[model samples]
Target: MPTEYHDLSNWDIGFAALLIIVNGVISVALKLGLEKKLIVASIRTITQLSLLGFILEWIFQQNNWFYLFLIILFMTLTAGYTSSKNATRFYSGMWINSIFAVMVSSWLVTSIALLTVIRPETWKENPAQFVIPLLGMILGNTLNGISLGINYLNESLINNRGRVEMLLTLGATRWEAARDSVQSAVKSGMIPILNTMSVVGLVSLPGMMTGQILAGVPPLSAVKYQIVIMFLIASGTALGTIIAVVLGYRKLFNSDHQFLYERIQKR
Candidate 1:
């Protein structure tokens, strides 16, 4: 069994980065015009991840709950705004609603996991180690789910405006009129995670498990951690998608059984 993990040096990292040239070469050969975008993306990845590494290292060293809370809040808010931008449609205060939905879902799942499943010794005193990574994973997946959900909801409402109005005119309640769209939107958001869960270990090794294995953790232990992460992601995605879709539904309808289709504007 491998007991010690290899520590990558700067030279090793530079060598690995050279792999991006393969992509640049392909783009140039095919006249795809993606070389510039690839270069920009590579630079951004290096800069953002390097800064995040330093910030996280400092936060871990301090072990202060206030700093941790502030970091988590910032991450959640950023995720909310990012998710809102995925929608091609716009409504007033959509960003605020996205933020609230993501914040609530990610925080709830992370808190549950910390308190129950992976209660590290210094969890209460210094949760930075566990909380940061776990919340980040959940938040990332939840952002995708929320984005997909909102986009689908908006598009569905716009495309089926006539059907929705017909149902409303037929004396159906708002919920009844929008039920199909709401269900479809929620399902669309969940489909990615559901597909991932279905073929996780069989089809591909997930990032957390692969990282742990590379760091010399026992395979079984890494698998357990990966399992926990998958469950947390699933829960967070479901909650975020449901909340976002429900909120959007309410926004596009009124208690008087009227469809407020005018509020949804295509961007």
Candidate 2:
């Protein structure tokens, strides 16, 4: 194992942060698009990271189960917020769906991966410090997939109402009629992830691997962790997206198996 490198304290974080402001200014002067977005993003990132840094320090000190539960609750809320942002009004109760999907898929995959794969004797020792980041990334990626599935399902059911009606007329079940649509939506949503898999090492180094290496974990172990996380992400993405798609389909269809195109409304 490599020795811990805590050299960043000597470096001026403020000076590095100033570069972001400079870039935003340059963007405005050059008429580049999204200057406002860049400014907002920089501010939000700073604020959130700062707050989370303090929370993490406190969490490390306490190391209590209640704090762990709070972390999970916050993750759920964040996943739901992201899902709700892109979700249609037609998909009522989508927050509930998002929470359930992220929680179930993340925990299922993480538990299995930990127990059967890593098998750390004391699982709870650094769960908040370690597992939470992995779960957050998984929840975030899964939310992206769920957004795609929900949007695609809504548009398809709206555009192909005639087909849906015809299926209903022919006694086809709601699930049967919309199965292909949901599947396609899921595939489309997951395409970026598939592409990421192909370029994981060649194009980019993931955060888990980078952080582990920086914190003195062996390169081989970091690589393994990265690979496991990517697989777990894929698993959670599929599960969460499927859940959203299925629940959204149920919401789109009614007792008579008819398409509810009229129900979708802009909020």
Candidate number of the best TM-score: 1
* Candidate 1 lDDT for residue 191: 95
Could you give candidate 2's per-residue lDDT for residues 169-215 as a string of tens digits?
88899877777787887887787788889999999998779988988
Error of 2 at 239 (Å): 0.5
Off by over 4 Å in 2: 1-3, 32-37, 120-122
- Which has the greatest lDDT? 1
CA RMSD of all predictions: 1.3, 2.4
TM-score of each: 0.96, 0.89
Clashing pairs in 1: none
Model 2, residue pairs in steric clash? none
Report the lDDT of model 1 for residue 34: 94
Summarize candidate 1's per-residue lDDT along 1-267 as a digit string, tens digits.
858888889899888778888889999999999999999999999899999999999999999989999999999999999999968997888888899999999999999999889876647676898999999999999999999999999999999999999998898999999999999999999999999999999999999899999999999999999999999999999999999999999898888988888899888
